[model samples]
Target chain A: MKLNKTSRNFKILDAFYIAMMILPIIFGIVLQVLTKPVSEGIAITGARVYFTIPMPVQDFPITESQVNSAIVMVVIFFFCLYITHGMSKKIELKRQHLAEMIVEKVDSLVKENMGEYFMGFAPFIIAIMALSAFSSLLTLFGLYPPTSDINIVGGWAVLVFFLITYYKMKCGPINYLKGFAEPVALLAPINFISEFATPVSMAFRHYGNVLSGSVISVLLGSALAGLSSMVLGNLPGFLADVPLFQMGIPAVLSIYFDVFSGCLQAFIFAMLTMMYVGGAFDLETYKQKKARKSAKNKQ
Target chain B: MELAIGIILGCCALGTGIAMIAGVGPGIGEGNAVASACEAIARQPESKSSVTTTMLMGCAIAETTGLYALVIAILLIFVAPGLLVDLLVNTMNGLK
Candidate 1:
């Protein structure tokens, strides 16, 4: 049999998709079997899983969400390294082409939202997008999604908030503080609340979306399993163990909750970060800063 | 005591369902926003990219109302039940 270029590419992508689906389960099973069971400080409720982390200083329990986030970080790190390991200036390799396309897309996205001066933020935006999408999609592999954990998304929002404040301070410290009281000083408290609301809303928005999806999927999965058992429990031997209702139904739901919503939430998070942080720096102030530096140099 | 507990649970379930009605406003608002965005894109095809981006940003902002309702519903369903159960236990013991 012969395949055209498009079909050949599709075949390769299909194989990659299968590998991605299977590898995580294999890893999960291996880890489960290899690790000794420690019932203490371990809990699983709906989609939220908490495990005690054996720290060197003090043992503190952390959610499985953080662990899954770390897994995603490590995977992305190695995947990027693998793709960008080799290069040919004359001829673009497949990996190089893919990497270039990703970079170009991220660059344009950042430029469009943040403008030309803030193009430096492209990498950070890309990282946030990639991490958010990957962590949320990890739910499909039966791993807890970090974004579903409020702490993880809250941390990201805090970082963005800090960046925005830092940029405002950098532009003009006194001006930044004074600007809050502008139009009317009586509205300062309201302004303060609105200012703080940005990060809070951003965090909750991502967390709520992912957590809802996780909770819904868990509910559906268990419902199916329960129905299967009620129907097939009388069957002898291995037949009783098969959750037949759960075999194919959840996959359809996963496409929306895990794949589509995950990608959309990630995009929204990145877009908000870019918009808020980019908006903090005034182009006029930046120009003034540049002009002041030039005058100092001449003197 | 069991009857009181059941009533508490039933009321919470009902309240959570009611709280989710807040979703209706955002659903309509988002539909209108998307319609306007589509209209704008149709008028100026070259500006589709920017129009879509702005529409998405507006949609996300509008989603806050729905998200708040969701948060409240989740708390009603999960967190309130345990706390309510604890309170009822304490009250029953006090009565004893």
Candidate 2:
């Protein structure tokens, strides 16, 4: 069969995309093979396998989540660099238009939530949103997603928490501290707990969602394989080993778990970060704005 | 000790199932939130985007309680049994 030039090009692209998707898993399996097994003395309880880095000084053990996160960071950095490099001033390229739209949207989102003065936060919010979304989605590529690790999400939440505290302190230390006691003094401990709970909840929300999705999908996959084995055990040779049911069912589940839940969790995390930080500044501006509007009305 | 362990596990399994009942709160809360958001949008069609965004944010926050319950349930299923047994063994050994 003779193939057209476009179809030939598409075939090459398809191969490349497939290879890109499979490369990490292949690399991981290769690494697993190459690495020396842990000694029988140390009991490893979890499902995660750690790769030991053979350093000149000492071997460093790193979890799959860390390795995957580093890979994700590098990929994002390079992709962003490549996409944004040598950009024309005019919106000639679709990439340029997309980039511009993203910037504008993020800027507006920050402005709307945090006010015009806090537009500087747009980049941070955008980065968190993108990182969270990409990390969660990385599970689709058979990688341990970064967000599945509590440390990654917790780190971002901690940053947000500090920002919230810094902004509150910037507003006024006395008022910020005093505000905790307000509406009633007895609510101070609850307020304090709630304050700490913000970051904890934010971190757990993303981590739990992604981790649960991963756990469910893995359980489903294994259950399917077990079912297949039980049902097909009597069948001869290769037919017994083939898990036919495992092919398309998990992909359907992944659409909801990996794609929908991942994106939703990412959006929620970013939105919460923005809302909490913005809210700190919004309090002062809101009061000022209200006062100004009331004065204007009276006049 | 084995019987105690079994009872502990059974109770935890039962408790975990009960904890999952918290899922109903978020389900109802989200449904109400969306219903109210839709009503708001219907009343002020121009404010649709803002209302929807707020609704989603509210839903996400409301989901926190259910997520907490889920985390607890997951821990009970995967982690708590082992830890409980370990604790029981340790206590018995210490008593010895």
DockQ for each candidate?
Answer: 0.58, 0.56
- Looking at model 1, give its docking quality level: medium
Clashes of each: 0, 0
| Candidate 1: tens digits of C-alpha lDDT, residues A125-199 | 999999999888887766667788888899999999999898878777877887689789998888888889999
Identify the candidate with maximal DockQ: 1
Candidate 2 lDDT tens digits, A1-299:
22342366755754555555456556755664565366542221233557577899988668777777766665566556544543565544455667778889999888887788788889898888888888887877666687987888889999999999987776567778887997899999999999899899998888888887887887888788878889987899898988877889999999999999999998888888888997876466557766888999999
Clashing pairs in 1: none
True contacts kept of each: 0.55, 0.45
Error of 1 at B90 (Å): 4.4
True contacts kept of 2: 0.45
TM-score between predicted and true chain B, model 1:
0.96
What are the chain A TM-scores of the candidates, in order?
Answer: 0.79, 0.78
